[model samples]
Target: MRAINAIRMGGVDVLPLVEGGKGVSISNGLSAGNWALAGGVGTFSAVNADSFDVNGRAIPQVYHGRTRRERHEELVSYAIQGALTQARRAWEVTGGKGRIHANILWEMGAAERIITEVLEQAKGLIHGITCGAGMPYRLSDIAARFNVYYYPIISSARAFNALWKRAYSKTAELLGGVVYEDPWLAGGHNGLSNGEDPLRPEDPLPRVMALRKVMRDFGLHETPIIMAGGVWCLEEWESWIDNPDLGPVAFQFGTRPLLTQESPIGNAWKQRLLTLKEGDVFLNRFSPTGFYSSAVSNGFLAELRERSERQVAFTTETIGEHVAEYGVGPRKRIVYLTYADRERALAWERQGFTDALRTPDSTLIFVTPEKAREILEDQTACMGCLSSCRFSNWAQHEPDYTNGKKADPRSFCIQKTLQDIAHESDEPAAVERNLMFSGHNAYRFGKDPFYSSGFIPTVKQLMERLLTGR
Candidate 1:
């Protein structure tokens, strides 16, 4: 396979390939740098990125403070430092060929602040920024200040158009491209909206064309649409190449990139990825962030599925206002429920549904005590760096979402577990406790002769295989 020519992305000639940013430690500076070195775009995840250490040893960042605002500030500061560190590391690894991009979630309370500080601190090292998980109307403006290109990951043309109409218009000049991340197949948080039914998956071609039409409508015909999620070997997607229906197209790889040698993920996680089988990927709303995500149906995810199955909607007000004793306390006793729900819950418990427990915020329900205990221990063993977690409500500093409330138990403390997994910590004892994001096609590795060791390839090798179709 001949090497593909570089495409213009945010004013830089970059390989069409993009390293989709994975949070925690999935796609950090090392991985992104390698991607850029390979002549592709690398997106370093700045969300909960590690900032510093006490004596050159990495420090755990937990918001032990008293208020939400205080906790948010600490998180913002740490992210800023983390972003800078990752950028410099990437620059060193890439030797300056690849453009380093930062990926951030849009809904962070201090998103704008963190981004500003990151770009300011990273300076020229960071060349572009990619944001998703929510409509990032302000992304263009944020990227503009640094003269960096901006890419907004979206699932549909309608969502893109809405952003353009409401806020992105002003930053259109600096808009590098749009990332059409396939909601159903991509790892991490999906962009699926309430109006969109999960069961009804729309065809990608039509949606791509619609996006192209929107670009044309906005006079952005020259802008490329970076197709993400479910993209494997080009052989599987040759029909879309140079096809007018999906104009100015480029493909982005999320899960596929993890197999690369240069990928920043831990070796164990990578090995786990190689063994996945078809139909093993699942999409569910297990993230405390309140977003639906796609991941492997491993022990962790299976438990969540089981817990959901046991769920029977219960109301606070009984038939008219009936109070029920759901837990052992007054607070638990105050819960209202219908007879049917009570019967169903009791039945589920009798049938072994005793694993259910409240989320950290107490607003949602999760698996029973066994798993909840596992998750809590996982939380307490904090490597510490999520902005606001539901599991432990552990912030980086004090005054955390302290609203005088404990972190919701419904939401797992992402910082604690992800850091542990990334660092290969043995404290958790169970890899299945954390969510593992992967694509639906992650099973391809098992059949590939090149991956016999379960030895994951470096980013360079992975990119070569992708570009060469071998």
Candidate 2:
């Protein structure tokens, strides 16, 4: 018999383990379906998940557009189709065994429209919706309308309380448990605010207890708090289970599950995780969307790190002050800069970092010509998907950018690299250039005896080990 400690989520007695939704194809139908098949919760990322191809093979389109609105519409349509298809796939894989959920980022321009259309269409297939990357204030209303459970992925108790007071309280019936994704350690975008210190890592138990307190105060004492991010072995979490303060807790693994046999990440990516060491992941605000993200320390991340490290406070005095040019066009102009910076850049260029890529509307600097050519090719082969990309400011009309500013190459086109890392044939280049997400405990993969058999466990195997103690 299943353990009596099972938590109820979305009206289903679900194993607390959730396959945290990863964007850009990290968590897809196959991975989520297997999670649900194991009687745990599965959440497929619907942020422009691959829909289909002419031959019906799933193909993700991250940057296929000539205009902002066009990219936005494609993202919506693709999400709707992908969500439905993935949910149905999960149902098929699990034989109707476990609960299936969909994950959506709240910051997308058409986040509301895409999500509503997806849940409305998926109907009985999708049991719940999990939203994060921003406080999803409208999540309650949207989920309630579809008669589906809604879970807001939050980092702190304060954020949850604020949401409950304003919107979620009225729809308490469908308010699914809150997901406590660790802000400092988790891969992808973090939720840490400006005042939050990343250096001093705090224990999650107290924070979860605080969340439980909020639940009790809001008449939701029974609501489970799904703990995410750095969670690893269940044995380590035994103290949390049935604890008076935490009450009805469940652990969600974001990085641990990636090593499972059933996880859909590319083999090269998996191998990279096994070899990753401490201090290899970095959190930086390099994204054009102005979000802080975590990525593995690879050649790509190293280059960005070097650039950020070598940054000099530059100023322009004349047109020739910082003169650098790329393609000849109406928008072409040399970026002005200080004499000292110009000399420093020239010296660096002589040191073999010769290629210079242009920020969409800003100035041009040096990159290896090869990297520049690759960036240009990738941009030219664009499939507009983001609302507006900083790499290619190819908007539908005159003003292609959102802030009405030019695109910035300092921030690489995120959609392009993520798509490459997820599915491209160039495995090494993908790992080298794109960011790879993993948990803080990812090193355990190399140290754990359980994985010593040269075989990774499947989702079902991992869950069984966790719940049944191997």
Candidate 3:
């Protein structure tokens, strides 16, 4: 393997391997700091990261607000403080050595506010900002205001072109890098556009070359393109390095870092990664943010799949082939379904899915009475985590503060599940019941000899391993 060399990113020379940021305290200061200490870019997630008390113990994010709006405000406050705390920790670990970037989701509730406050408070501690999950046109402006670099995470060349033409061109100097996150294989929320098919995985080389071409068109030839998603080892990506067509490129490891010693995920969650198979990580489109996401095919996902499977389309007015009347909810509101669908619904009800819940897509999904109650409770308890949520129909801004759509039963509250999975004690049951995000290459953990006997490497050790191309 060719020797790994330091590359310039965020106006600093460092190893091209960047630590990908995970959310809900999974990628905390320890992991980010250690990665930075290893002479690589360290990114701590600002998406609802945890803040600690005086003794450094994590304070539980228990919401006492009476209204969803009030809870949302509290959440934003928590997010800002948490980001600051993590930034400080990362800076401390780095000792003014490596680059530190804060990662945020553009669609997250009060995203602009959180990032603005974090940059204002963090100052020189954070060197860059990496954002994705939406077209964050305003990201460059915020980063420029703070005198930090901005890395916009995108899956296609068109996304970068749109960003460059709109807001990024103005702050071209501080445009640190562009993160090319593979939509079909990347973990967590994906940027899969309507034109793309999730079932068909495309080669990263062609797409990245296209992105490089677009970047060059905007006079961004020198800016590094951070390759993220499905990146396990440097050996497989040897050809990508020093490839003139792609220009300066860096590798971002999202899933591999989860098994590291400093990763903040619970032990049960870490252990589960070692036993995964090729098809265990599923690219699903069930996010409340209305974006495609990749997660483990665990019990939580299985339940969602089952609920969606029990769904039947309905119409208010009877049309051809949709003439069967069905009563939904306690009020017995009438909706028309097909004869075959009615029979399917009856069969599901007989199988203990007695309650029928209406979705935003003019569909009714059958679920257990207990599950129906749980879904309502989760929706009622929504604190507007996302800018707009399909599960609870909660929108952060404007007149009514609602998306003006019926709550979809097929999706669940992401904030609640992430916090649950991240903070829960080392218990397999709790870990399995919540969302577990992973890249498609997570199966490599079991197959790789480096992870034999479930040996979790430190960030420095992993860097050493990557350097040897093992």
TM-score of each: 0.86, 0.87, 0.98
Ten contiguous residues with the weakest lDDT in model 3: 423-432
- Evaluate model 2: give its TM-score: 0.87
Q: Which stretches of candidate 3 lie over 4 Å from their true place?
A: none
Where is model 1 more than 4 Å wrong at Cα?
A: 1-3, 52-58, 313-340, 343-409, 425-429
RMSD of each: 4.0, 4.0, 1.0
lDDT of each: 0.73, 0.73, 0.92
Tell me model 1's lDDT, rounded to 2 decimals: 0.73
> Residues 1-470, candidate 2, lDDT per residue (tens digit)?
23526678778787777888988667777788898887788888887677777897776555456655566567667777877778777878877776888988886556788889887777887888999888789999999899999999998999999999989999999988899988877878888877788777788878878888888999998888898887767776776777777777777777877777777677778777777777777777776556677777778777766654434333233454444322212354344556676566677678775654445434445666666666667556544444345555544334533445554556666766776787752376677777676666777777777777556888888877778632
Q: Poorest 10 consecutive residues of model 1 by lDDT? A: 357-366
How many times do residue backbones clash in model 3? 0
Clashes (backbone N, CA, C under 3 Å), per candidate, total 36, 17, 0
Higher-scoring candidate on lDDT, 1 or 3: 3
lDDT of 2 at 2: 35
Q: Rank the candidates by TM-score, best first.
A: 3, 2, 1
Residue 48 deviation, candidate 2, in Å?
1.9
Best by lDDT: 3
